[model samples]
Target: MEESKPVSYYIPNPDDDPTNERITRITNKIKIEDLIERSKRIKGCKVFQLEGRFVNLFNEAYQAYILGMDYTTVSLCALASERLCYDLIESSKITFDGRIISNIEKESFYRIPFSELVFFSKSIGLLPDKVAGKMMKLNNMRNVYIHPSFKRDRSDPEKLQIKPESDSVTALNNLIDIISGFGK
Candidate 1:
């Protein structure tokens, strides 16, 4: 008779897997470490030179996150990502108004609001819809933190408003991913 297969060979249902949390935590830690290392390497590399500020911003954001300043980190990272994305678009050799991008034209593009920039980038295929969407979300988050009027929505007048810590980390990670691609 053929030997029977062991019961342990079966794949566990993803929903019921008990080790998923631990695995996810470990994966996130590795990703953070990789990001930190990449940030350091980016400073000295030619390909990354033009976009170094974005990397620096991410590094600062990562440090802020490590220090429990998640809100500031997220806001700063979002701003950095916006600048990096705009820089990429301005430098992509894309033509506008029947002319190649000029320094003066780039400056004009920079003056456009973040929402309009995102829209323009998306329309020109400079940014994927998903990335553009995340940029918009991060911009909204930044606006919420930067503009005082946004906080008026709180039902309680006395309690201190606190954003979830994970949101900041996730936002920073998404921004980093978006910025990291610009150099290529």
Candidate 2:
């Protein structure tokens, strides 16, 4: 047998957490059986009809939640909702879900905010009131993490909520519920 030093291979630093790496050593993290069971929850859920782009976003959101990438999951859900509103803009004649869409001064029409999207979506017949409210709540959850407020104070109630897992799960479930309720 020839001797090999393999000096180019990664040498772990003392300060680094070994559990953070070790892709080849997949143990000590999420157990395979547990992950399988967790994934089964998704497999068992009621399937909702989604558009092409939404399908990708929905799938990725589930995968992120399963993999414990909570922030990513929450963000994806928000993006999906935003995309839904954007699609309505593209298909319907109304602008900002209410304003009359015109050819000129395109910037104003294109600059719809997320809050407006959710609110106006409900204001019109597009989204149900409950679904629109839930979307707004989900957007708020995403904003708390994605856009941290730097007030230099401790008044923010969301800061007290430990871990992103709960928020991510909530966002994912709310999104699914909204889509499921679309028909009825």
Candidate 3:
């Protein structure tokens, strides 16, 4: 199936406020730096040790958002969240339950799909209720790109506008808030 492309590729839409990018750029750098510094303190933590992996994924998603690639941004955002979920679940099991979640179980859980991760995280109280709901919304938004069946109104190519850049900024902020204080 042909993917629906954004109406404008890397072009500024006059109808949208351009100042948002400037604000996002400044805040994005600050948040990333804050996360890096925060992660540095927990040198032994799994989330800290693996920061290079999924954190980079999150950064790439942020970059995609800045470049106006909404679909790619959302897709990568979901992937980064999924990776974080796996890490958090394993870490929590080890810390709270006094057992290592086996690689087999981890792999099986990872394969179960994104929405389930949100539900599982919520059920375990890994995230606060409001954040979990936002994560669910993000997962649902992501499914529009990943699952063909979830996509609707693909016929209007011109109407396939890129999501406002602020949405990506907000998502990244939420992600940082979710994992920033781990092992703190």
TM-score of each: 0.62, 0.69, 0.54
Expressed as tens digits, the lDDT of each residue in 1-184 for candidate 3 is 4544676325556776767775556446555555554344322313445633677887787666655555676777767777777766655653236777665666666677667777877787776666566566567667765675664466775454335354455555555555554433
Model 1 bad stretches (over 4 Å) = 1-52, 151-164, 177-184
The candidate that wins on TM-score is 2
Candidate lDDT (C-alpha), each = 0.68, 0.70, 0.61
lDDT of 1 by residue, 33-63 (tens): 6556434422222234664356677667767
Segments in model 2 whose C-alpha atoms lie over 4 Å from true places: 1-21, 26-30, 40-45, 93-109, 150-159
Better of 2 and 3 by TM-score: 2
Q: Which ten residues in a row have the lowest lDDT in candidate 2?
A: 150-159
Ranking by TM-score: 2, 1, 3
User: By the lDDT metric, which is better: model 1 or model 3?
Assistant: 1
lDDT of 1: 0.68
lDDT of 3 at 109: 68
| Pairs in clash, predicted candidate 1 | none
Top-down lDDT ranking = 2, 1, 3
